[model samples]
Target: MNHQTRLQALSAFLKAQRAKILPDSVGFTSGNRRRTPGLRREEVAQLAGVSPTWYTWLEQGRDIRVSTSVLDCIATALQLTIDERKYLYALAQESGSGATLLKEQLPEISPSLKRILHELRFCPTIITDRRYYIVGWNEAASHVFLDFEQIPSEQRNMIRLLFTRKELQRLAVNWEHFTKGFLAIFRAYYGQYVEDEWYERFLDEMKAVHPDFNILWQQSDVQSAPEVLIEFRHSKAGKMLFHLTSLQVQGSTDLRCSIYTPVPDSSTEYKLKQLIERK
Candidate 1:
């Protein structure tokens, strides 16, 4: 296909994927009469840091230059996987083929890795990539987070839910800990990637709804915590204390897995016993 044809295809792919957004999913309210898809074009434009007019042109595949920096920004706005991100860069290429950043393939986790975690059933374990997609999990992991499998793969992003989904806010018993991750995840994106329209677009959207976000955005300091101790009221496990563990990917160093350990010999253990027995 011609370069223009290629760009249009990729751009259309992104729009189709994004148009399924729910207003509350992105921290907006869809009025009754608004007949647009998930989020409006303006919402995506506002969040992605392009003008409605310019971004519309992009969706239409106008001959405007699509820079690598812009693609990185768009990638963040769309919450793309590293593989998906590389595809974006390839399509954004001006003339010919270009190197796609990030790994070609992430090495498969050894069978030993799964077996080791399986033995520690009380230690809630989950393997998630940079995109925060759950890749692996143990029973404990299932107990800690509710309805994980029920969530659509695209909507699994923690940051999107933290700000948009009401159920998540309620489910995440440790709001502070989760909020910190949200801050760190977005901050890391900003640090490794370029400053683009997407940054401003999210900021503006958050500012419209959450003043605290605006305050934090201005400070520009985000902390990443490897170990998290939090309490959750699980449907099956009941109220439990968990010690969270996070490990970064070895080769790409982009993926992360987190395991939450139940506190030793506590009432939480008793509660878990009672709940599991009842089932």
Candidate 2:
């Protein structure tokens, strides 16, 4: 979709989702009879910590210079999952262009490569496309993502999960920093497959969620892999920061091998060891 249409869609989507939440669902008692459908505009405004006038303007697609923190609050109010939230940011990126292609399209993952990842199962690993789609994962990687298996087959982008799912937020040791980097990576990876329909659809979804994503996407920040330290707030294992290591697959530039490295002599390692032993 074009930028203006996408922004309007985002505004409408937020309004629709906000209207669906009964005050009781978000913890406000409603004793009066129905006026307009769903919770009053004021209710959502209060819950999201935004002014009612500002919320209305945002819904109306007028003068919304929203910050990530405010958008985060709105996500919480709207009960968006992490994937949805990331999609929201993607749509709200700063770029003005239509979806651009980063990587050339390729056929499906080869059996030989799949076998290799399986063999490397001891390492926490996942094979992702340029869009950060969770194309394939081994046992160790799968174990870290217990909830991932439950996601609808197509909705498997890591950044999306980081925003929409509360469990994802729980898993984030430093969510804000992690998420910003994730967007930067997407921008870097854009040259690979930005023209793909799936990538555009991903952008559209974000536009429906957060305007900030639209702004960021327009800025076109290159998303090459960086020296990343990620904080994983694991459910059973608790929290730790791991350095991320990424390698592009030989034949397919879009496919990547990313490993998580534990810090030396850190409590995180001890935690991982104990967690592994228990399993």
RMSD of 1: 13.2
Estimate, for each residue in 93-135, the C-alpha lDDT of model 1 and write its tens digit.
Answer: 5432222222233335657778967887666677765434455
Of candidate 2, the 10-residue stretch with the lowest lDDT total is: 94-103
Q: Which stretches of candidate 2 lie over 4 Å from their true place?
A: 1-107, 119-122, 211-220, 276-279
Question: Cα deviation in Å at residue 136, candidate 1?
Answer: 2.9
Instruction: Please report, in order, the local distance difference test score of every candidate based on alpha carbons.
Output: 0.60, 0.65
Candidate 1 error regions (>4 Å) = 1-113, 195-220, 235-237, 270-279
Residue 109 lDDT in model 1? 62
Can you list the residue pairs that collide in candidate 1?
A: 21-38, 48-197, 48-198, 49-197
State each model's C-alpha RMSD to the native.
13.2, 12.2
- Indicate which candidate wins on lDDT: 2
